[model samples]
Target: MSDILHVATRKGLVSFKRAGNEWRANAPAFIGQPVSAVLADARDGTLYAALRLGHFGVKLHRSDDAGASWSEIAAPAFPTVETPDDNAPAVDMIWTLVAGGADEPGVLWAGTTPGGLFKSSDCGATWSLNDSLWNLPERKDWAGGGYDLPGIHSVLVDPRDAKSLTVGVSTGGVWPSADGGGSWRLTGTGLRAEYMPPDLVFDLKMQDVHRLSACAAAPDIVWCQHHNGMFRSIDGGETYSEITGVKPSVFGFAVAAHPSDPNTAWFVPAIKDELRIPVDAELVVTQTSDGGKTFASQSDGLPAVSYDLVYRHGLAVDRTGSRLAMGSTTGNLWTSDDSGRRWTQIHGHLPPIAEVAFG
Candidate 1:
């Protein structure tokens, strides 16, 4: 089980430390500022926090000694392309941040709004835009989901191969790169997009993947919580197979995969895309231990009549695959000690959670 849990909220970034069985919150950091994303790198015990200040712009901070101290670092910035008529796209938010593989220390990968990927080889001292993915001609057809421009929120680095990466884009589809970010190919074969036209329903680039999680022990098994429904990929996201007929509704933004068990995964379901709330005002978590063949609704400690919603980054499972943490848009936080069988509400009155992670 993890001893530390970090939550990025609409107001600030909160950290919690587990003492024996009870988790205690530390003095909140960056209060009164909206933390867009938080990353606790297990590689070197480094913590990275991204703050989205309305008028001050986006800022990135790093804490080498846990949360005791922090220093401002260079946030990912888009290259200046001074075309006479075209304005270079600015990075509005760092949607997702992940450290490189175990062997590659001081390396980081960041996915940003306006649909761009960045790489840092010097521990975020500087960043360079991936021109291969950014200059792709197909990007012209990409559209946004929640934001005005398409954003890459999920970046999965193959545990076995640091160069192999898969990213899930909203309003865009699944993109896999075998030689790191040097080249890219759009996948997501069996995914369906009901929001698109009949002819474009199966278009790989038209599908909206809410989030993507792959089992660390079984890297080939990838789970996708898509805008249309839930999907699973057995071959490392090269292709996908939609899992349908789920209880409640299949519309949700978050999905957390067991770290060791490929067949075991968790999903927080909502009514649908039109109604982003619990099914019939009940917030329940659906778990599948046998791939997606069967699902069990685990809500022993959840609210019976609630209106909380979990975002794509709101659900997370620790390295043990036994400890899980979930946060909601309604300021509710819960943790499960035995997978998803039951949950214990930690905080019900925190700021609206944007992301949660266990370190």
Candidate 2:
């Protein structure tokens, strides 16, 4: 069987297949404006994508034929609107979508751009606002300017329990729902919140997490790539310990856990500053064979010198744990078939990419 890769691009959704050593790009999956998120449900082989139009609110698209074609679904309305701005009503853009409920194959959970959690009961055909999270008092404090509260960048559903879920807000920190979004609590104990002053205890911004991946073998085990460095949580994010140590430039955007090994994972470390110079940039994918105790640079096949910036939402690893792919804002997609130790530019002719996913 061929491995299919889904890429969310500025132009539209693109699908590619790995045939031998070459990646052949297929026709655009969604037409019109750019796509914000593209995901493939492993439980039912259904494809879900979110489109971001200029002022026309976000739209959800789904493809049952594995990106061969797509159809638009009626977008769900955001529950709370303070005042109707002169502009168009801001629709919550879905950032991440995951298949939920083993008994109900079509049930899907989605995280939104405004950092709200949602659910789709009819297999991505329609969705409803999850008030359990959207109506929280803390939801009003989410910031949305820059690397801040852009949306729910990461959403993790427990593999063992369908009722448990965790989501990461760009600046708001991590929130956990034990009863499937009915009640939520801030799980940012060890995370660094930037709002807190430097001298304060447990500043929120110390670990502005962008991506979260739970170990398949150990559900309580999770890894995070924060704005500062990398972190690992053995107790399902209750607390975390910095694993990157004193690396001069330890800023990264994405993290991927090994499919079968909870202690092994990979991450793409970018240049620390905005200068975009590679002299100080690591430009390497770091790996930890024994969890996050120690990480070694895995740059055998990656660029030796480049200023490509890997965004916070762009790195992903396949279920087989053999392939790793990361999309760059510089409009290039890098793939590694040998567990991130080696990589190659599979596709780079498209517009700047926002996110990438493999199933």
Candidate 3:
């Protein structure tokens, strides 16, 4: 069987497949619509794509035979406004989609802009709002990072326990739930909010998490690429410890954990928040085989000088711990089949990519 990679972009969704020792990317799907997120579910090999249309609103598309064809599903929608004073938030973007556990078939989770979490028990055919998280008082204080509304960009569900999971928000900090989507509690004791004053940096409901990745083998081990620095949660995000020693810079958008080993992971470094481009305008993928103690920059076949900025969902590592794929805002796509020791640019000149997945 060939290893296939799916890329979600501002323009559409694209698929890349391996051919012998090389790879090739297919034409874009969902043309014209900004595909915010995509998931190639491993449990049943189902494909789900989230799109943002300027005219109609948010949409979710699904494909059973990979990307050969797709059909639209019932996208997550907010409850009808009960009264004129109702504070219902509109859905802006479907930031992330995650498949449920092995025991929970047809279960899928969606994280959206305005910080709404929804779950669909029948693949992507329907969705139900998670009011348990939406009614929290802290939701009102959560502000926007890149857009006018806060978004739940990273939803890390434990493959072992579908009911227990963690989600990353731009200005809302990290929220983990123990009883599926029934209820959630927020935590930021270890992570910092550098954008605020020193005294207010550690205040509740104040965190900017760009990306979050948890080990599949050990769900208790969580790795996060925060807005201020890199962090690892040893107790399933109950608390995080900052890895201040990450060379170059830990302020980045993407983080990928090893499928089995909880110690090894990958990160794509960018300049500080002020300069979102690659550090020194040079593109590199830093990896740490020994946790976050030290990282080695991998630029074997990557661009020499680049200014592309990879979004939070752009980096993905396959199950075997062999294939890695990432797409940047500059429309460049790169993949590595040997644990990221080397790389190959398989596609370029596509739209600003949003997310990457493999199946």
Candidate 4:
């Protein structure tokens, strides 16, 4: 069996495989416009990708034989009235796609750009709007600034219990659902809303959590990377506490959890100011072995003090927990097989990468 890596770039969905010590890129699977997100089902090896076109709206594609070929599927239509003025606003775009259920298959979920949750039953053929999250009473007050707006960047499904799930947004904080998408609640406690006064009750623009990962051993444990700092939740998404104490920049876009050890996780830190550059201007990966109580830098083979920017959707760990891979906005793909202690540049020269996943 061959190991495949699916990446979403400005060109389209591309596939890569390991050949000895080098990585080789395959032909473009879906070639039309840029793909926002690409995911492979661990259960069946089915590849699903989200394509965003300038005038064609959002399109979902699926491939059964890996990324060798693909077919387009129709998206769910929002409810409408006979009157022309009652038309629903177009879906901004899909930013993330996640597969659920490891045993009894046939479940998929997606999050959109304007920050809406969606579900699909017949694989990736069609979808339905999850209004339970988008229409929540608290959504009316959500706010954004600069390039940070309300868009779902991460969606985590509990391996222990398929019904429980968590979703993270850019400036909208994190939302959790106990019984799937039937009901939802805001679980942004201990997260500082940057736009509000320190003494205010609930600041709508605070806690811009970009990445969230679940612990494999302890399903309730989760690690999150925010615009301001890093946090860990012991009791699922109910609460979180600061983890990084080195006065690090605390402004990064990606985080990943160890496949076997729930307490071990990784995060990339960048400068936190409006300039949005790397602090100390170096590319490094930090790891916490004792859940988020402490953290240490692990950059034996990474770039030393350069201006490479790792996007929020680029960091991922394989199922075996042996290899760690991440892509940068500067068009370089780096991989570390030694649990992030050392690194290597596997593939570069591709267009700007939006998201990456290992299969």
Candidate 5:
């Protein structure tokens, strides 16, 4: 299990270190600033934080000596467009960040708002946008779910091959690349979108995938929390099968797949998109140990009767697959050591958490 936990919140980036049986909070970095994403790269012990400075624009920072110190790095930007009709969209926020494979040192991938993917070879020194995905003609059909424009929230790099990648866009659907994003194709079949017209219900391009997570040991076993319901993929997102009839509700924004167990995954359930709150005003994390065939509602230490909602990146499981951390928009946080059987509240108030990561 990891002894450190990093939380990106609406106010700032906060870190916690495990102290015996308790987690102690460290002096928060970027305090009072909205931290949209945080990545604790285990490859080189480097820490990265993405800040959304509203009117000031997006900014990124790197910390080599953990959270003790940090320096601003180059944030991803769109290339200048000469034609007025070909107006390139600016990056509104850095939604997610992931380090390259062990063989590729100093390489990083970033998913940003307005549906753009960027790559860096010299850490965060410079970035180049993936023009292949940006120039997709079908990109015009992609619409926004929560933000003004669609965003790529989940970027899954297959453990077996660094060149193989899968990205989850809010309203753009699932995209898989075979040649390090040199080429791309949409292939999320079996995903049903009730929000769309009946004729386009099965259209992959219209499915709103809130989050996508894959088991580390078995990268092909992927889990998805969709706007319509929960889905599972055994072939690395080429296709998915909706797992319906989950208790409470299958509508949620966050999903976490166990690092080792392909059949085991966790989801934070809510009422629905129209009513984004805990079922019966009670928060719970549902667990599926049998590949979504069955579910167990686990809510030992979470709020009994309250309104707390977890975002797309709010839930995270450590590398050990034994420790899990969950943060909420209401500023509540919890940790579970025995999978999802039981949980312990680590902190009651921090800030509106955007992402939780372990290192």
Candidate 6:
């Protein structure tokens, strides 16, 4: 059996395999289409790819034999607007595609741009809009973080309870639902939005969470990379505490948690808000083994003078916690088999990377 990494980019999907100590990326798939999200279910070794076609909106595909072959599935679609408005909510991108818990086999979730969360019971065959979230009175206040519409960039399903979930939106703060995706409440109590007025920074709905990762050892321990800084939550989604001591810059787009250690996690720091490139013109992945108490930049053997910016889901850790893969908006892909202590570029100059996952 070989360890594989699937990278979704602005142009297509790229697959890589571990050969000896290095990751070797293969030819691109879904050529010419922008692939936004790629996930693989370890339970059955099935791969899922989310694509964004220039003129055709969002699409999804499933591969049972790894990336060898794929079949198109029923894509997620929003219900017609009742107000006859041209600006009605429409899905322009599927920012996240996640599999449910191990016990919940065929269940899957798709987080789409314009802020819609969809669920599918039979893999990616069909979907149902979480009307509860769509009709929520608070949804009217949902705004875009940087794009023209809001998007659900992160989705976390409780490892112990598939019925409980947490979602992170661009401008809309993180929200948690105990009864699956039914009723929800904003859970950004300790998160901050420094972009707003000083007095409004702590508003429950004001935080801008760039990426969220859960510690596999403890589902409640979450690490968040935010627009302004970094944050952590030990009580699940109840509250968060800012990690104020991270070096270089506090702002970043991606965070990855150790698969079996709640206290260990990683982040890729970029320049602060308004400027989103690597700090000091060098790209580094920071790691913390004592929860969020401290962080250290690990960039040995990696590019020293670089200005690459990774997307929110561009960083991912394998189940063993011994491998790391990250791709950048500049179309550079790097991997580390020594738990991020050293890195090597396996692919480059393809297209802007949207997401990366290890399978």
Worst 10 residues of 4 by lDDT: 140-149
Clashes of each: 0, 10, 0, 2, 0, 0
Each prediction's TM-score against the native? 0.98, 0.91, 0.96, 0.92, 0.98, 0.97
RMSD of 6: 1.4
Off by over 4 Å in 1: 83-86
Candidate 4 has an lDDT of: 0.76
lDDT of candidate 6 over 265-328, digit per residue (tens): 9999888866778888899999999988888889996788887998899898988888888899
lDDT of 5 at 179: 92
The sequence of per-residue lDDT tens digits that candidate 3 reaches over residues 71-171 is 88899988878674646568889998998888999999899999998899999788888998989998988889777899998888887778888888987
Encode model 5's per-residue lDDT on 1-359: one tens digit a residue: 89999999999999999999999999999999999999999899999999999789999999999989999999999997787464557999999998988888998999999999999999999999999999999888888976888999999988899999998999889999999999999999999998789999998889899999999999999999999999999999999999999989999999999999999999999998678899999999999999999999998988779799999999999988889999999999899999977899888888999999997
How are the candidates ranked when ordered by lDDT, highest leading? 5, 1, 6, 3, 4, 2
| Residue 58 lDDT, candidate 2, scale 0-100 | 84
What's the true lDDT of residue 138 in model 2? Answer: 72
Q: Once superposed on the true structure, which residue ranges of model 5 sit more than 4 Å away at CA?
A: 83-87
Off by over 4 Å in 6: none
List per-prediction Cα lDDT, in the order shown: 0.92, 0.74, 0.86, 0.76, 0.93, 0.87
Measured with C-alpha atoms, the lDDT of residue 55 in candidate 6 is 93
The true-versus-predicted C-alpha distance at residue 250 of model 6, in Å, is: 0.6
The RMSD of every model to the true structure, in order and in angstroms, is 1.1, 2.6, 1.5, 2.4, 1.2, 1.4
Q: Return the top candidate by lDDT.
A: 5
How many residue pairs in model 1 have overlapping backbones? 0
Better-scoring candidate (lDDT), 1 or 3: 1
Please state the error at residue 144 of candidate 4 in Å: 3.6
Is 3 or 5 the stronger prediction by lDDT? 5
